[model samples]
Every structure is written in structure tokens, then in C-alpha cells.
Target: MNESIKKVAVIGTGVIGNGWIARFLSQGYEVTAFDPAAGAEERTRLAVNHAWPSLEERGLAANASKDRLFFKDDLAEAVSGADYIQENVPEREELKKSVLHTIDQHARMDALIGSSTSGIKPSILQSDMIHPERFFVAHPFNPVYLLPLVEVVGGEQTNKKALEQAGRFFSSIDMKPLTIHKEIDGHVADRLMEALWREALHLVNDGIATTEEVDKAIIYGAGLRWAQMGPFLTFHLAGGEQGMRHMLEQFGPALKLPWTKLKAPELTEELKERVISGCEEYAGDQSVSDLEAKRNEFLVKLLALVEEYWPEESQAKANI
Candidate 1:
């Protein structure tokens, strides 16, 4: 709903692409999407329908409607009139570059281009574009309609004004835009997540903990506190009256301890089976769809609580 970006185009229809579509539609943007897959439109519509209830819980824009979504089989036609284009194609480098070339050829000259790539640096992704200044990475978490954080990273050629506009546009759609001026592989959030993921795999691979136990450790302990204040702030409180200073003084030595394996374990056949079977056993009778619905419900309520208790302007400024 940003004044300058009314018509939006999503250039893929996979899970992430559909998630963007649902979020854009809920924000009342007229979304035109393109995907070459068979029944891509049908699948996207179903995905939107599945996410609609959670969006309703979060509250939709006054003019929001599923009817506002449209699909075009031709990529050029889909993006021709859009003010903003979000590409969610697969992470394959050459495929992304080729798709971006087509988008660059057809999209309006001034249209802002954002890639939903989780890890690829924006610089490399934009290198082949004629209007690279308008291109950047706008990575969002899974369940894009519910998660507010979007890492907006600019490439070397990206114009500051364009990046600012992208940030403002995302903010208008109820997103927390973390503008990362420097480009790096995986940006910020994903790197932090990857670190933890590496250690988790190590634990499972080493026969130290079952996947279920790992989930419980986070769910019942750190995850709860992390939902409110992240690691730094949580540890700041852990320092008691002296804050982070005391906490660091007391625990800094642990940083050198070999308690964690930062490198991820190899995904051997046995490891894969263990992970797959463990998850299946934990899931029991619940299908993936059922779990997704439950997760959406929990996220809706958690988002509300987070908004109520989390710090606002001051906290954000302090982080900088």
C-alpha cells in the first residue's frame, strides 16, 4: 500500500512465492504473479486460502481481498505494469540470473526489484541486470504473511534512494525492514540461524540428543525468552544489576570451550534416516498441513503478545 508501489508482481509460485502473494494480497496490493509450472495458479490460490484465516487473525488491510490477485503465464506480461517486482524463483544461481534478466527487460524502468533468496549476495544476483541499482535482496522468513522481519540488503550498484524506498514499501505492508547496507552471503538472520542449525545437526549426528529433545530445549527454554528479547538483550538481563558487563565477566570464557561444533555434520544416509524417521514419529497422525495450521494459530497469538511487550522505537535505535 505504499503510495508509489500499488501494483506488485511475484515471479514464482513455490512456497516462498505463494507466501509473498498471500502477504501482498492481505496488504491490499493488486498482485500479478507468474510461474511456468503446471497448475501453478491453482496451487497459489490454495496456498492463499490456507493462509487467509491467519491473516484475518492478524488483521487485513481495509481494501484487502483475494479477488485482487491475478496470474499471467508470461513473465513479461506479469511484470510490465508492476511498480514492484519480487522474484522468488529457486536458489540456483544461473536460473536466478536468467530470470532476473527477463524481468529487467520487461519491468518498468523504475520498478524496484527484490529477490527472496535466503543466502545469495545481492551484488552477485544483480551483476547481470541493466538496472542493478533498482535491485536488492528482500529475504523473509517462512510463513511470510505472519513473520514481520524482512532483511533488505542492497548490492554494490544499488542506489541508496531505491533501497530507502524498498524499506518504506515493506514497512507500509506491516513488515519490519532491517536494511543491511553491506551485502554478504546469507545476510544476517539466516547466518545466525545457520550457526544454530549446524550445532543442532552435530548434536543429533553425535548421538547426544534426539531431534524431539532438541525441539523441547528450545521450545521450553531459550525460545520463549528469545521471542521477546533476542540473545543480547536476554543476556543483558542475565547480568543482573550490572547487565552485560557482569554476564560477560562471568561467562566470557565459555566462548573458548568446545561445547559446540560450529561446522555442520555430514548428511550421511543414516543421519538422514534418523532425522526423517524422528520427525515422522514426532508428528504421529498430524499431517504437514495440520502442523502448519497449528503453527499459524500459535504465531498469530505470539505476534500479538510480542507487539504488546517488545520494545519499540528506542530499542531499534539502540541496536544501531
Candidate 2:
């Protein structure tokens, strides 16, 4: 465990898993990736190629290169010598449990295994693992190569030392790991996001707004501030020097008003079609790959800006 991680294993080659492999390789780790899905290797190669430009702009490590990635058909062979393992299998409870248990049998006992699960609790996924203490959640946002935030949540059987080790390793790869003190299904970011998603779906289902309109509401408003400071801190500034207390006092009464729908509307065929068509309209003539490249480039610049300005607030608070 004291040794530096030279090799990492990625358990799936889907979007999340592909991103992880690219991120790891960009940070100079030799990565061995395995997926049971047909054409997974080809998809992984294309995904890595598509994401490499952003990583290069962001700056890669001394040894970082796409050539460092290896594909393995056998799961055990993929993880055999890896110092760390990231599981990006589909988010099904029993499926994750089974996959994790199987991985546990092959991977080095000391290697920390993390799930890129967006919502599933780690305790359940690690239930059948031989060394549950080394298994935890390392949930990263999409386009993992560009995003710095990664949620690190440990299960009931997870060891604190193992979590610390994993967090340190993730940090070394330039990720900001937020270690959740208590386990939650969606962790922190996703829970807030799910609420906003449900509200947006309600808006669309009620014919109040199109998907593009909902997106504009975010891209032009709070999303800008959110890149630097979180909602709580941003609202504290809205208090006009009285801080969050005044902000809460002024806006607290509005909480009783039914301004939003908490429950999501059912995804009926009409709703699905509306959403799908709206997305198509938003895309216009751009293919999925085209849109993804644009998004990644914007995110790379945005994250760089955040990294530059984000520390100012912290320094100012410290001066106070």
C-alpha cells in the first residue's frame, strides 16, 4: 500500500469507464481495461482519441500517452498487477455485487476497488466482496478527464485507511476528492442534481418549457456562479453583507410556496418523444461526437478558469 500506483485496471469500457481509462493514461498510469461488450475495445480507442485533445490542453504527465493503455479480454488478467481498480459496470445492485465479488477474487487483496456508481450505495455493491474494506465509491462526473470533482464514499465495512489511500491516489491524478462522512445513495452532487432534474422534467411534462429552455435557464444563470463557488456561498453574498442568515430570513417564507414540483412526472411516450425531439432540435445538425467535442473543449477552459479564480475566495475568507 505504501508503493506508488504504476498500473490501474478499469472494469468496464462504457462512457464512464472509457473516461477513467483516458484520465488515468493522461496522468501517466499504465491502464489495463476490460469489457465484455462486443466492440468495446474499438469504442474505448475512439473515446480516448476524442478526449486526448482536452487532456493535452490541460497538460499531461511526463509519461502520459495513449500508447500506455492495454486491452485485456480476461478480467483477472486485467487486474492481476494493478495497484488500483475502478469498476464502471452498469448501476444494478445485484450485477455490481456479482461483478465486484468476482473482481475481488482476482485483484490483489491490497488494491483498492472503487465503483463509479452514480447512485447505488457502496455497502450493497461491496457486500459479497472478499475484502469489503478495500471497496468504496469513487464517483466522478461525466467527461472524467476534464472534471476535477470525484466523490469518495466508503461503505460500512470500508476501512478509513483504505479510503485515505484511495483519496490520496485520486488527488495525485489531479482530482478533488470529497470524502463523504456518511454514506448516501446519490452522494451529494447527484442528489441536488436529481432534484433539479425532477423539477425540469415536471416543467417539460407540464408544457411550461422545452428542454433547451430549461438548459438555457441553467447555462445563463446559477451555473456560471456554481463553477466558482457553491450555491450556499453564492446565496450568502446575495444577503448584502448580512450573510446567509439575512438571505434565509428574506427568502425563507417563499419555501412554503409550491414553486416547484418535487415528484417527477411519469415518462409517458409523449413526454419521451417531446424530450427526444427537443434534444434533436437543440443539436440541430451536429452529431453526438460533434457536440461532445464542443462540450469537452468548453469544459476544459471552464475548469481551468475555476482552478485559477476559485482560490481567491478562500484566501479572502482566510484574511478575514
Candidate 3:
């Protein structure tokens, strides 16, 4: 096995996979990718090209170039001798496990495999792998090149050393590596997001607020605080000198109040139309691609501001 990651193989070049490829290439890693879909190479290349300007603004690595990307029709050829591997297959457990098993068979023994699965447990995906210890979940948010947060969760059979190395590798790529202490269905961020989404659905189902209204509520309020401080810390400050303890005491009774729906509302046709129509009204005539471009532009600016504000942490993580 190679001693360090010089080349990376990206398996399943969908949105997430292509994002991973762009990120690796921006960091100057030779990236070989494979996807069986028709026009996979074209789509992946276009995705990378679309993402390149943002990456260039962020500053590319010395060896970073569009020329470093290679597309392979064969999965085995893509993985063989690769120093690092990133798997971004579908969410299905059986399919992901099957692809991972093949990737493990072909990749170098010491090369770590990071899956882009957001919800699936690493243990389930690695169950069929011949070398399960080398595999772990390295879930990143959408627009993976700009977003630096990556949740690194290891499985029961996953080697602790491999997790550490994976953290180092992700950090080296200018990402925030969150090593989850335990295995859970949704991991960390997604679980928190799921709770909020369920309540939002209930609100929309009851006609209490339109989807756009709910989004505006977040966009103009708690969302801003959440960008810099977590919910607990934000509430802690709300306690005013007494900290989280006082905040909990003051609002603890609200926990039992019928203020939220933990269970998601039914996706009835009416509610779907209301939500879709409301979103469309809010979006005007914009397509999904148009929204994505706007989002990436805003994200790039925010990423730079945050990095500048917390230079010590972000830069130190990048130096890993």
C-alpha cells in the first residue's frame, strides 16, 4: 500500500460523488472516478467545471488542475492501487454494501474508504466488506466542495487508527472532521435537522404557515445564530449569566407543551401541492439549477467570512 494519499478514486459520480471529486482535485489529488450511468463522465466533468470557479476563488492546491480528473468505465480499474477512496453510491444499504465490498477487494489494504452516505450506519455498509476496518462513513453536506463540515463516524469493526487517519485526510482537504462517538441512524447534524423538518411539516399540514413563511422564519431568525453558535450555546446565552442550567429551568416546562410534532405529517396530495406551490411562488421562475448556483455563490462568501473569523481553527484543520 502507498504510505500516503496522492491519488483518490471516486465511486458513483452522482451529485455527492462529483462534489467529492471536485474537492479532491482542488486539493491537488489525482482523482479517478467511475459511474455506470449514461453520460456519467460528461455529467461529472460538467459538475466539476461548474464548481471550479468557487474552488479557484478559495485557492487551489499547487498541482490542482482540470487535467487531473480521469473517468473509468470499470470500477476495479478506478480503485486499484489508489491511496484514498471515496464511495458515494445510493442510500440503499444492500447496494452500497455490494459496491463497497467490490471497492475493498480492489483498493490497497491501507487505503481508507470514506462513504458519502448521510443516514446509513457504517457497520451496515461495511458488513460485507473483506477489509471492513479500512471503511468508515465520511458524510458531507451538499455542494461538498464549498462546505467544509464532514461527519466521520466509525462502525463496530472499524479500526480506530483508520478513523484518525480519515479525520486527518478530511481535515487536510480543508474540511471540518466531526468524529461521532457512537453509531446512530442519522448521525449528528441530520438527526437535528430531521427534528426541525418534522415540525415544519406539521406546521404546513395544519395551514399554520406556508412553506415559504417557515423558511423565512428560519432564515431571518435562529438560522443566523445557528451559523456561529449551536442551539445549546445560543440558549445558554439567553439564560443571561446563569448559563444553560438557568435556561433549561426557565423553559424546561415547554418541552412537554404541544408545540411540535415529532412524527412527520402525512404527505397528502393537498399538503404537497401547498408546499410545492408556496416554494414555487417564492422561487418565482427559477429552476433547481438556478437555485443551486445562487446557493453556491452565497456559500462561498460565507465560507470565506467564517474562515477569516476563525482562522486559527479552520487553518489548523487544513494543515492536518
Best by lDDT: 1
Residue-level lDDT of model 3, residues 61-143, one tens digit each, is 99999889999889999999688899998888889988999999998888889898989999999888889988899999988
Q: In candidate 2, how many Å is residue 160 off? A: 0.1
Clashing pairs in 3: none
lDDT of 2 by residue, 17-89 (tens): 9999999999999999999999999999999999999999999999998999999989999998888999999
Model 1 score (lDDT): 0.92
Model 2 / residue 73 / CA error / Å: 1.2
RMSD to the true structure for each prediction, in A, is: 1.8, 2.1, 2.4
- lDDT by residue (1-320, candidate 1, tens digit) is 23499899999989999999999999999999999999999999999999999999899999899999999979999999999999999999999999999999999998999999999998899999998999999999899988999999998899888888988898899888999868888899999999988888888999999999999989898999999999999999999999999999999999999989857889999999998898999999999999999999999999999888887634656332
In order of appearance, the predictions have TM-scores of 0.97, 0.96, 0.94
Clashing pairs in 1: none
Stretches off by above 4 angstroms in model 3 are 1-3, 310-320
Question: In candidate 3, where is summed lDDT lowest over 10 consecutive residues?
Answer: 311-320
Predicted structure 2: lDDT: 0.90
